[model samples]
Target: MNKVIKIENGTKQGVLNFLEHLITTDKISGVLTLRKINEKGICDYGFISDAKELKFADPFAPVMPINAAQTLSSLTPTTKPIAAIIKPCELRGFVERVKRVQGSMKNVLLISYTCGGVLPLNTFQGDGSEKIIADYYNAISKGETPGSIRPTCKACEYFVPMMADITIPLLGNSESESECSLIMNSEFAIQISKEFQCEIITSELDSKIIDKVLAVRISEKEKLYNKTKVTKDGLDELVNIFGKCVGCHGCSRVCPICYCVMCDFESHNFDYNIEIFETELEQKGALRLPPDTVFFQIGRLAHMSFSCVGCGQCEDVCPANIPVATIFKKVGEATAGLFDYIPGKDLEEAIPVMIFKEEEFEEIGK
Candidate 1:
């Protein structure tokens, strides 16, 4: 059986209240989520042991390179009966990673929000700052899709959650009249629903509304892919777009899945021999001062393509205003499609990079 409930006006407030009840009544430990601004305007992650610290749940909280999955996996000794709030992308990564680790899913509660996509760091419609999202939240609690959101999001097909204990649909359907509606999936969610004892009502969703939103996303994606070709065209576009880039590399450094303790791209492998350098310098008028702009990006893509969550942090941290996330998502999608894989959708699905099958692509292999 399934239980669906809708909050009249205090969806966030209700969620916070539930978390508090879970901690006090249920005796759970902590809740993990993307950090948001608290009352003091301090930027940090939301961790609630007791009720006083629970901020209004903002699934789009920023400056977070590490998510519940990565953070949960890294704990020396994992904790149990904890609740984690994550976006669709982050939850998928956690599910996939936990399947492999197995130890990560012992007693965790998953709280997922229906994502409408997020804004890129360097390019957005607000006042040239990240706070525009928070400001938008304050102004319109409806969670307007960020103006400078990535094309991948506009086109992304993976909007639904398959593995969540409890799922919150942000893009409303028939219950547009209610605040936000909760759709319970797993038995864990049902248990939570029974424990909370909130109003039990069947969730009535508007399939047409959901379809319309997905159609718009798919349409935007096709147009984006149609607009971009292979890496060559992408490079010229990047050079043009990021002409002012200072090679800070903050994007990759802050990304959650760019997870090489030591990246080979930054290693001495690319340090050209003095003779080769002189020859190339004389042959061409001059090489770009940072020699491996293309190489750097390609290396990162190859490393994490199968696992790329499309968090938009690369473009966020770029000094040159480059659309790094867009390009990465395009490449990641192409490569993932080649493997017939979608990151974060299924925990049982094989990872393209870490695992392989012999007869996977006979047409391409031949």
Candidate 2:
């Protein structure tokens, strides 16, 4: 049974009020949201272990707290479950990683809010001091949607949080400048509704409007796919996309799904002997200092193409501003498409790249 609860203004303040009501009555362990401090401060995104810590879920706060999903597996499972507030993309990314890292989800509840989009760290024109999401929100509240989003986010058409236990809508017939509709998608969600004192309404959602929003998203995604599709047919075009890589390797370090107990990336595995180093540069008139740049990315693609959630954290941490996420997302899309799979779409289905079976590839079985 689907139950809908309406809120006023959909402000951070109101969201917290409803959440606090649940917490006080022992409905959930905690609820996740933003905590604003005067329009400038690092927004902390973590589990609110206690209801008193509701200050972090501030409405006017600017910060993207996507790390909470990564935190869930680290904490012990609780009888008192938690309600997480996340945007569409972050929720999908974490759900995908939890399975790989063997993270715990014993008592965590999912709550996803609508996404307006975001500005990356570099191009984001702000105070430029300690780069935060609050500044970006301030811009967005004024109806200035960031001209550019992380390439992965821009291409994503699943703007709604499909994996969430509870779904909130900010688009179409449920539209309200100050309201976002909330609904429970499961039996547990129904039990939680007992915590609320208001009547749950049955509202009509327009299927036609849903199609329009999705159609626009698909058109935008195809444009991005064409724009980023560069072939290895020549070096010039490839160089234009990945030329300035300084071998910092920031992307893999921040990715949640790139888990390896013994990464060859570290522990001097790639370190060359004195004779080997001299011979490589000696053979070529000029060898790029990071000689295996293209190879390294391809290696990661081989390891992670199916699991790649395209969180854009690689682009976030890049110092040389290399288009790393764009390249990975493009490659991942093709690799995943060949198998007709979308990474993180199904929690029960194991990643095709990670598992092999004797009966697999049925087309060639005969």
Q: What is the TM-score of each candidate against the true structure?
A: 0.80, 0.83
Clashes of 1: 4
Q: Please provide, for model 1 over 127-235, each residue's C-alpha lDDT reduced to its tens digit, 9 standing for 90 to 100.
A: 4454665553442234334454555566666666658888776654333334656777777766755667567787644466567667777778777766655455666
- For residue 136, model 1's alpha carbon misses the true position, in angstroms, by 5.0
Clashes of each: 4, 8
TM-score of 1: 0.80
The segments of candidate 1 whose C-alpha lies over 4 angstroms from its true place after superposition are 5-9, 34-43, 55-72, 75-77, 96-103, 120-152, 173-180, 192-194, 202-205, 226-245, 271-285, 363-366
Please report the candidate that would top TM-score against the real structure: 2
What lDDT score belongs to each candidate, Candidate 1 first? Answer: 0.64, 0.63
> Which ten-residue region of model 1 has the weakest summed lDDT?
136-145
Residue-by-residue lDDT tens digits, candidate 2, 310-361: 6677877788877677778778888888777776666776777666777666
Clashing pairs in 1: 92-344, 121-316, 154-217, 155-217
